[model samples]
Target: MTEPVVIGSERSEVGLPAAMEILLSGGSALDAVETALRRCEDNLEDHYVGTGGLPNARGEVELDASIMIGSSRAFGAVAALKGYPNPISVARAVLEKLPQHALLVGEGAAFFAQECGFATADLLTDEARRLWREALGPSVESVEGENTAAGAGDEAYRAASLELVRRLAPHDGPWGTINVLALDRSGELVVGVSTSGYPYKYPGRVGDSAIAGAGNYCDLRYGGAACTGRGELSMRAIGARAVVERLALGDDPESACAAMLTDAATLPDEFRAELRTLALTFDGRHGGAAGQVGSVYALMTATSAEPEFRARRVV
Candidate 1:
């Protein structure tokens, strides 16, 4: 049997070593993938996911995450979740406890997390809040309360604040996320993704990170794929599923990722430049591509002592 292997989006390096240890210890692919993403979620330095993550325009941290067990194609997801710091674990619990459901959102997701014994915390950190205020500039003080939009009694001020938010929202710029894919020695594949969603987004906004086909897709019979960056474009194109479908058709991992990057290039320049994808085949082949230059991804195998960071192929 082949040794287990794991690959992930660029930021996965923060947790890849631990994930490989899990696989080496005879852990299931699902466990390895989940463990890896959980580590990323705990990395306070990464302002895009879990603890210390950036908040929405309302100054609340809303998270999204998903997990897929390729052997059975079982998928679980949570979106627009608040208070919880580990949406990936919540997603895994959803997969195990809610066999009949594939997704939970907003208050329902939060409720499920609490039922699963997950603790709640104010996910926003001072650093993230500082960044948010920086993006909003001097106009931030004009808005009332935690609301992104202007409250009643200030029509003109509200209009200006809204316009500033539209121009400066993190969704319009570069962002980060974590996608972990594992192939166990027995050939079982599992993929997962986690993110705090775009910074300074409106309340209840959800990105591709929690959406199955858009953020993550896995099929033991084919392979697995995950994506990051301007998630709206990825969701519109079903980006991750398209990459896995290409692998299913017998394309090499690099070819499959490049093909999808090329397709994404046709979108508006802003969206196209922010598009990126990571792919892995059932046989253990893996690669990534990005619409923007200089992007990269990480890879690790059970036999590898450490993760390898490789530049992504640009379309």
Candidate 2:
């Protein structure tokens, strides 16, 4: 049997080493993928996810995550969850414990995590809070061509803050996420994703990170795929699923990802420039692509001693 391999989104270096350790020790693909995502989720230095996530306009942190086991086509997801730092683990629990359902959202997801004994914590960090405050300052919004301040005790300011968040949130700008894919020696594939969603988003807003076909998709017969960047664009394009479907149609992993990225480039400029994807085949072949120039992904194989950061071919 061939050794296992793992691939991840641009920042996966943060967790890829640990994931490779588990794979080298003969862990299951699902286990390795989950462990890697958990590491990223706990990393306080990463403001895009978990403990250091940026808050919503209301100054509350909400998280989204998903996991998929290719062999069984089983999926689990949580959206708009508050106080849970490791939503990837919560998603795995939802997959294992809740056989009939694939997704949970909001308070229901939080309640489910509590039932599963997941630890809860405030996900917002000081740095993220400071950024949120800065984004909501007096210059945040303009109404009727008049600059409005988001200062305290001002109704216009409050409305301006909300509008600013609405426009800039939900996968705009330089937001980030983690997408990890693993192929075990036994040929089983598992893909997982975790994100804080768009920084300073509205409360209760859920992005593609928690959606199965949008942010992630896997099939042992074909491969697996996961996406980052603008969640709305991915959701609209069915980004990850499109890549896997192309692989299913006999395209190599690289071609599959590049083709999807090319398609993404045709979207409106806002969504097009920020799109990115990573893919892995059942046989351990992997690749990535982006709609904008200079994007990259991380790769780790059984033959490699460390993860390699490779630049993506922009479409």
Q: lDDT for each of the candidates?
A: 0.85, 0.85
Give the per-residue lDDT of model 2 (tens digit) for 234-278. Answer: 888899999999999999887999888777666775423377888
- Model 1 segments more than 4 A misplaced: 143-153, 169-174, 268-273
Score residue 30 of candidate 2 by CA lDDT. Answer: 91
Error of 1 at 151 (Å): 6.3
- Clash totals, every prediction: 0, 0
Worst 10 residues of 2 by lDDT: 138-147
What lDDT tens digits, residue by residue, belong to model 1 across residues 1-315?
868889988778888888888888888888888888889998887889998888887678999999998889899999999999889999999999998999999999999998889988888888787888788777676654565654465676666665665666463333687899998888899999999987777778888888888989999888999998878888888999999989988898888988987776676754233778998888888889886678888888866878988788887
Against the hidden reference, what TM-scores do the models get?
0.93, 0.91
Candidate 1 lDDT: 0.85
Q: Model 2: C-alpha RMSD to truth?
A: 4.5
